[model samples]
Target: MSYSVESVAYWYLSKEEMSPKKLQKILYYAYSWFLTLQNESSDELENKLFEENFEAWVHGPVINSVYDQYRHYGYKEIDKFEGDLPKFDSEALDVMEQVWEVYGGYSGNELENITHQESPWLNARKGYQPLDRCRNEIEDKDIFECYIQRVN
Candidate 1:
């Protein structure tokens, strides 16, 4: 079963208040590992939790849509989600849980520094300088391949 990015975002926000940047990084990691492990488990792209693409933003990978949804909040911690919690498949929930366990401690800036050194973000920003404005879409193939190689 798949879930929307908003649903996943809410799940993260539900655990702790976070800046939009932190939310975006957590979501990216969740999606990355889920994509990597899901393929090894089932070998199918159709099982992706969300279809939304992430742009290689200066801070890191950002889902433009999700970022826009919280842009008004600026750098402050986004308000706690007021909506009822959403449901998830066991596998999806596990992936999210594991993602939090691994990444929840880092602040937005720390995660940004970490992603800056990663291949997916680096490849997407290819030919672009550190401060260059870029919105190049990070390919799912590159994300999956790059992350899978690192993990295995």
Candidate 2:
């Protein structure tokens, strides 16, 4: 059955299936990807941006973000997921579907737009031209592929 972000967070924090070290790495990588996307804004920087944002987009957001986004959609509390961070699995994938819709297919532009309106992290990069430039790079490659991989 499909799982929600709250369930995944509970699993990660409460269960003993995955290693703490592994979970930490995943979290770190995922956060790093968000930072990279936040920083990059040019298409010319695709390779560099990918290198910097790789883990964040590939694993971090694909999994963690999905859970976070989904849990929120289901009207679940953020504290619950934040309380735990390792129990993610296929159920998190269900949440990811919801995230994609919320994100408008994970378009960097959409992320930027929403980030401007809500997310503090993206707010820092506000009016940063390079951030806009890199939108296409992420859309053409990372966003589409990541969504397909996660759902499949």
Candidate 3:
């Protein structure tokens, strides 16, 4: 069963207070890796950790809901999520852990830079130039193949 993106967002925010930007990128990576690792689509309802689709915003892939919830913090670190945490299936837990271990160290700026260089975001924002405000939805297939290439 898929949890809300807010639940997973709080899960990551519970781990560390990140700027809305970083949390967005981490969640994007988590979603992408889960797709590649499980060999499933984010559209596969039973397999999704959350139902949210990411938009290729100027910074990176931003989940509109997550961004709206924390956008008030601007570039500042979002305050600790003072509420419920998430329970994950073992596979989802492993994917999130692996994402954290690898991408967690980077700042929001760095993660944004990294995602900007990636195909999922680039493909979605193809017609828009850098610094362009594009809200095109990122395709999960592109993201799945993008991360799979890194693994192979």
Model 1 earns a TM-score of 0.93
CA shift at 106, candidate 1, in angstroms? 0.4
Question: Against the hidden true structure, what lDDT does model 1 obtain?
Answer: 0.89
Clash counts for the predictions, in order:
0, 9, 0
Cα lDDT tens digits for candidate 1, 13-33 = 999899999999999999988
Model 2 per-residue lDDT tens digits across residues 1-152? 22343343344334232322233333323333332333333233242112322112221223344434444334222232334344444434333333333432333333434333322223233454633322211232433333233333
Highest TM-score against the true fold, candidate: 1
What pairs collide in candidate 3? none
| TM per candidate | 0.93, 0.24, 0.91
lDDT of each: 0.89, 0.32, 0.84
Which 10-residue span in candidate 3 carries the lowest summed lDDT?
Answer: 40-49
lDDT of 1 at 149: 79
Candidate achieving the largest lDDT = 1
Tens digit of per-residue lDDT, candidate 3, span 48-71:
667789999998999887878888
Ten contiguous residues minimizing lDDT sum, candidate 2: 47-56
Give stretches of model 3 more than 4 Å off.
Answer: 40-46
- Candidate numbers, best lDDT first, in rank order: 1, 3, 2
